[model samples]
Target: MKKNLVRIALGLALVLLTLGHSIRLYQHPLLSHLDAITYDARLRLTQPGGQDSRVVVVDIDEKSLAEVGRWPWSRDKVSRLVRQLTDHYGVQLVGFDVVFAEPDESSGLRVLERMGATSLKGDAAFLASLASLRGSLDYDGQFAATLKGRPVVLGFYMSNGIPQGALPPAVLPAGTFKGRNILFTSWRGYGGNLPAFQAAAPAGGHFNPLVDFDGISRRVPMLVEHGGQYYESLSLAMVRLLLGNVPVRPGYAEGGSGSGYAGLEWLDLPTPRGALRIPVDENVATLVPYRGGQGSFVYLSAADVLQGRVAPASLQGKVVLVGTTAPGLMDLRATPVGEAYPGVEIHANLIAGMLDGSLKHKPPYALGFDVVQVLLVGLLLSLLLPSLSPSRATLLTGAVLAGVVGLNLALWQSGLALPVAGVLLLILALYAMNMSWGYFVESHSKRQLTQLFGQYVPPELVDEMARDPERYSMEGRNAELTVLFSDIRGFTSISEGLDPKDLAHLINEYLGAMTTVIRHHRGTLDKYIGDAIMAFWGAPVADPDHARHALLAALEMQVELRRLDAPFAARGWPALQIGIGINTGLMTVGDMGSPLRQAYTVMGDAVNLGSRLEGLTKQYGVGIIVGEATRAAVRDGVFRELDRVRVKGKDEPVAIYEPLGLAGSVPQAVLDELKLWQQALRCYRAQEWDQAELQLMNLVRLNGDCRLYQLYGERVAHLRQQAPGDGWDGVTTFETK
Candidate 1:
């Protein structure tokens, strides 16, 4: 009980920390970013992907610029487009995503007037012509005349720079929000339309989107303040105009005032159908409920509209937006849906969401809800996890995580935008804390056993020993095991060519690589003697496939040594080669050393025979040599019998084989060659010198670089000259160790 108390206290502290981040008592940047990411993921998953025809973007694309002249085209051209949209196509509402801040003077009226005042003064023909062309030459007046008495909403922009052009009347009057503590996006200046355009429309809205800290434009301020006056966004203005110019009113939560929180939650617009509520966040901004990618709404080229090339029914009753998609105009935005999304589409999505009441709401009470959620989930996990076993704790944690994600998604589908990152992170933190505490603090005896055996055995075996520590020790015992020995060929000469420092580094690298291969194959590394390595399997933790593991490790050691060739040459060191031998038999294993310094090792005749096989690899011209027992134990292994030999210390001859590879992995060509070699060896043992010589000649023709074939070829020739009697056996005896 006392042990669990510390973990419980630590878990609770994590809960409190996450709670602080949730309620904004303090902010965690990583948690906030994660919340944004999760919100984007949920939004994308639930978005209805089909196109929405209710809102359309009249794009000023590159095609339009190429067909017409460059941008800031004569106002007469723009006026014609407006007349075609409203009179010919009968669009329901037209909102501009672009602002006309300067007057159009491309009609040459100013130049003609100046010439009349100076260069061509008092010329009667010129004066009459000028007087007659006055009405036709006034382009700005033409554009304003086209805008009058139409359901067109001009767009403006807000900023902190100096005010430019003219602003329309505010949506909320001065002093309307005097005592309220609503947090609106405030600006000091704006770039509005010209006076004539604003007066002709009598309704204009700002097109400035609210860009978050990560540079993604995810929301727009529905009501922004400029010089103590509140103005609606272009999307809001168009929606109001479509609903018969409904009055905008602030909607607040009922019980917020009691807690001194009077933040506005939504904007209410009373229509004939009902009161349409547009949800807003603490900054009076609403999330843009993106329907899909860039083509969520239909896009018709502005040039098509001007030239009467568009179908009339496509624009009928459609709420149209006029904006540019031309790259030179730079109206692209980084959005959650795409990095290069059209800015005009943002307004269209908002207008569509407002009409359908699908705008996601992140109300002020969401913070309180987050606080409560963290408290419930964090406390439940904190108290329950410490008392549960590991498997049960994992299952419980998984269930809680699923529940949290599921509930959050459900709320998201219902138009709520509550954060889920804090609670999810809290659950994971608590689970990890409890699990780590249990492993490190409670299992002291297992840790001691791990420390003792970790140096000699692989970590996997040590983990198994930890499960039942009483069964494993350094005490010596006899066990049927497989032992391996590997030595670097010509290591003495290789060391003589390099400096002492270089040699030391080389040996460390070689030893490290070979040891890693041994551990990877589940072999216990017994020791390293100079440039040699010794390892064994089926001790400490017994493996049923000990012979297979030892053979695999020996084969891999040679391959690993070859991999060092290029790097060694690059460092001015010689290419390295190693010979490995593996044997399987009964042997003594465990801690075996003097009292002065103890070591865990293995010994017996099998160990000594394994060493002898490693010494014969150079003579056989093979990388790995294995005794008969190892080759027999591994039924899946492919080996070519090298010889039957009696070493210096043993009188009984043993068959030795060179491991080709695993059965399926060995090349068919190599297997065929091995068969021919076996035939030749059988003939040589039978004293059929002529047949053996013929087979050796064919093998040398196939591969002239084979040292084994050459060595046997010399033996056949020598034995033909000095033939032994039939009483002699076929065993080759090695007199040197």
Candidate 2:
């Protein structure tokens, strides 16, 4: 419970930290940039693909520039283009995406006037010609005359530099938005059309777009404030003119004004068709609804229009925007759809979207929406992930991530723009934190288990014990186990022949080989005493077949010792042999020793008997010997009973046997020899000296180097000579260990 509380606390802290960024209490540049990236991707995916036919771009393209001259062309030519569009092609409305900030002086009327004033002062014929040509030479007046009583919405630009030219009447007059805390984009000055042009045109709107920090033109301010008056954008003004010049009113959310935040969310323009509600963001801006890439609107060259090359039916009733697409004009903008997008189409897209009511919005309330979304997702995952298992946690994280993304996409389809980066980042961070913490805890436990039992057992057993660490400990406990004791024969004599260094090397090599055999059979090594090794099974990690395993280990130890013969001889050392004794009984096993030094070992009568049996192997001329308990436990092992003996420390006789592989493994000759040997032992114990002598001689003749047979033969001869009474049982007693 305490651990769970700790994990939950960590998760909640992460939630709060992420929430700080979501609510704008603090800024994380990476998260903000990621959010913008996601917004762009969604925009690209959901764009309306087909062209918007109501708007057409009258492009002053390379062909127009080639036919006509450079920019700042005579206003009479611009007037002719406008007249051709309105009078010849029957275009409904014309909005210029170009400004007439400076008067056109290419007509050479100033030079003509100078000559009339100075050089041709007294010439009557020249004066009469100039008077007749003054009306035609006034190009600005001619352009203004073309705009009079027409639905022409001239474009202008707003800036922070010195104001130039004349601005049209403000859409919302000064003091109209007093006490309203709306953050409309503001500018100090502007470069508008000339006074005569501004007065002649019905309306004009600023053609400035809102460029984001990444330098992409994604939005346009619907209403910009300059000197305490708000003016409409080119797209908004054109939209209003298309709808019979309707008046725009501010649309605010409920209680927005009362809460000191009169956030302008929509621009409400009432028209004959219906009330046109164009949604805006916190900055009173609308996200540009890009229809597609370039060519979303039809383009007609101005030169073509002037030369009557374009068909009138194509431009009839189409709202036309006069703009330049020529590269030298420098009117290209970086937009979400294309890197080199024409600046004029941005207004066309906005106009089309406002008319169709298809604009996606990110209102001021979206901040609250993002905060709620992040809080719900962050806290839910943080608290729930800690208690789940690793697989379950991973599954839950995936489901939540999918759900968050699906919900975000759904909201996007519903025309609401909410950010997803923060919530996604939070989910990933919390999952990594929880998963890493869990791994560290489990690894720490495994390390502790390894440190406790590393030296006693093989690595495989240690891993198994680590799985359930609470079940095993170093405290002493009694268990039915099998213990083994192995010692090198003639170790003292062998050591005397070699120097200390060689002796150490030989002992290490012999001990390593024997220890490998012991561990291979899953025996836990207790300790090494000089040239002897002690090991046990069925403690710390239990094995039900402990006796069988120990017997197999002893048999393999002899085989391993024999393999070292060649190597020992190559080193100019004597050949080595070992005697192993194994026994099974109840014994105390665990860490037991003094404070200065402690060891994991076994101690009991059964353990001592195992040591004593290893000492008796040389007397019996066998490589291995096992007590009766161990022999009985291994049901499939083949054994030859050596004797019934009472060792030095015990009064009761115990049967001892030498293991000879498994049941089907013993040779037929060895089985025959064992049968005859049993008969010889029976006769010798019953005092039939002659029969025992005959059988023993046969056993000797079969194998002359048989130690047990020879020992029994000498005993039988001694009994025959002494002639003891028939009160004897077959048993041998030893007075020394």
Candidate 3:
């Protein structure tokens, strides 16, 4: 009960911790980012693998660098590439995954004008020549003129530090929203194109992806805030530009009544094709629905278009993104499917998804859904597990885990992004708690059991007692019990030829096997003396049918010895044979010994008689011998009455019996021999020596190898020569132990 209480306390603590963390009452780093890793795996598993033909990439790859000089190839060269896309290739629109912040001065127009003013001021022709090439020398002007009326949008970045370059006007300018307050991810700085290029295009947008805590890009925010105004992302801005420069608006969800706070749900872009809805989370972020890895979009080299070597069919009416694929340019990103992904392709995926509406949805209330999910699982497992067995608890926990994953997967398949790692971690934690409560918390009693019975018995016996230790003890007590004694035959001779290690191993293995048989019948071990073993039942934990259990255990031991014959022979060792003796009577059993050491053992005449019977087994040429008391106690057993013998330390002769098998399971032929043997004993006691001798002869003829029959036959012959008195009873006497 104390263990269970501790488990309940731990469970409650875990639930409270999770609750507090989910509700933001407390913060912990250990439990954070687990959801991000699990979500990465889910995204990888469910990635819709195929090429998205809507957006194509014009990569400034190595081929382009080799063909068209190095990076920052003069603006006039870029001008030709743009001209071919618009005039020759018939492309729909283009976007730059770059920021042209610095002016291109590769034309040397400033140098020429400076030389004319300093050295050729008197030469009007030289000054006039430099003035005549003013329009041609201005490369920035050349590139800006090419982008004036084309369907093009330039890209920029926003940072939290400070404004780096000029930022374009917001899609929904400041003071455009009313009534409820809304918040957006705010940025303080940006890297924008030159003023001339910005003025030429209709608009520009930020392309800042919200990298997760682990530095992997999963969600790209649809809107960012600057000076209390909201601006659209590059993907959103690109779609708006593609739809003939439609108007973009902020969408708000109805918040709780009178809270004066609203949830920004989506960015609505009005277009002639149709009105497009871009869903956003509370942070205004959307999970990136990656179609595949890097090759999902078509990649064309910029040099191919400038050199006029590409077909127009590939570029006609295709949305093109101009970005560099060179590693040195540092436009690479880490994604679920790849370690080095191009940043431009990320925008392409997002824009393509916005066009086709394959983007996944993760709303703000999904956090509440995760909290409730964890709590419900915790409650159900805590209530259901304490009443179940260990195996049943394990089975139930596995089913719950499977169900959690299955339900989450089904939701993911339908494009709903929910938290999975938290629920899974909760189930695993609760299961571990439940299992550990039983194992570790209850281990004190198990330690006690092992200390009391480790050497005397097998591990299985201690394990059985560990199930309920209160019922068993080492304290001495008197009880009606059955004691067993067993020893190997000719062990001294067997050990003389073997090494000490081999001999010890052989003995330990034999003893171990016999002990297992004894414990299997619920018997408690007393002690071992050299090659002998002593065990008893109905003591430590009592059994009413101790005699039957002892008898069965003895029979099982003999059968086990037989089964070891081939294995022992294969080891080049001699075959082993053993004798067992069992007796049932009142005896003192418990932890009894000298001051130096005490052991859990059995004592009294019954135990001594059990030992004496084991010694007599060899004399009678049998595997086992049981006292008449034990035979009577186990009434369901079939036995052959050997003789009424007076052993050492006993005045009255006790009847000894050999157990054949369970009742009705013994062979009829053995029963016939037993009947004839009984008749022989009766006639010998009646002093009818001739008739006794005749019965013994018939018994020996039926089973010649039986030593009991031969001994009786010889006794009848001796009694015939010297006739005994009528008072003489048929009994055997032994003077040795």
lDDT of each: 0.91, 0.90, 0.84
How high is the lDDT of residue 257 in model 3? Answer: 31
Residue 216 of model 1 has an lDDT of 89
Q: For residues 63-132, what per-residue lDDT tens digits would candidate 2 score against the true structure?
A: 9998998887889999999999999999999999999988877888889999999989899999999999
- Writing each residue's lDDT as its tens digit, candidate 3 over 430-508 gives 8888887746546678887878777676576677778898878788888999999999999999999789988988888
Error of 1 at 579 (Å): 37
**Model 2 weakest 10-residue run by lDDT:** 254-263
For model 2 the local lDDT of residue 83 reads: 93
Task: Estimate, for each residue in 1-737, the C-alpha lDDT of model 1 and write its tens digit.
Answer: 67689888999999989988987988898898888898889889999988999998999999999999889788999899889999999999999988899878788999999999999998999999999998999999999999999999999999999999999889998887767888889998899899999999948999889988778899999999988888999999999999999889887787232434568888899987788999999899999999999999999999999999999889999999999989899999989899899999999999999989899999787988899999999999999999999999999999999999999999998889998999998999999998888566648889999888899988888888888998888898999999999998998899889999999999998899999999999999999999999999999888999999998888888888889987788899998888888899999987877789888899999999999999999998888999999999999999988889999899999999999899899988998898899999999999999999999998998889988999899989989999977976878899997
Better of 2 and 3 by lDDT: 2
Itemize residue pairs with steric clashes in candidate 1: none
Q: Sorted by lDDT, highest first, which candidate order results?
A: 1, 2, 3
Model 3 residue 216 CA deviation in Å: 0.9
| Runs off by more than 4 Å, candidate 2 | 4-10, 255-261, 436-737
Error of 3 at 234 (Å): 1.3
Clashing pairs in 3: 162-189, 163-189
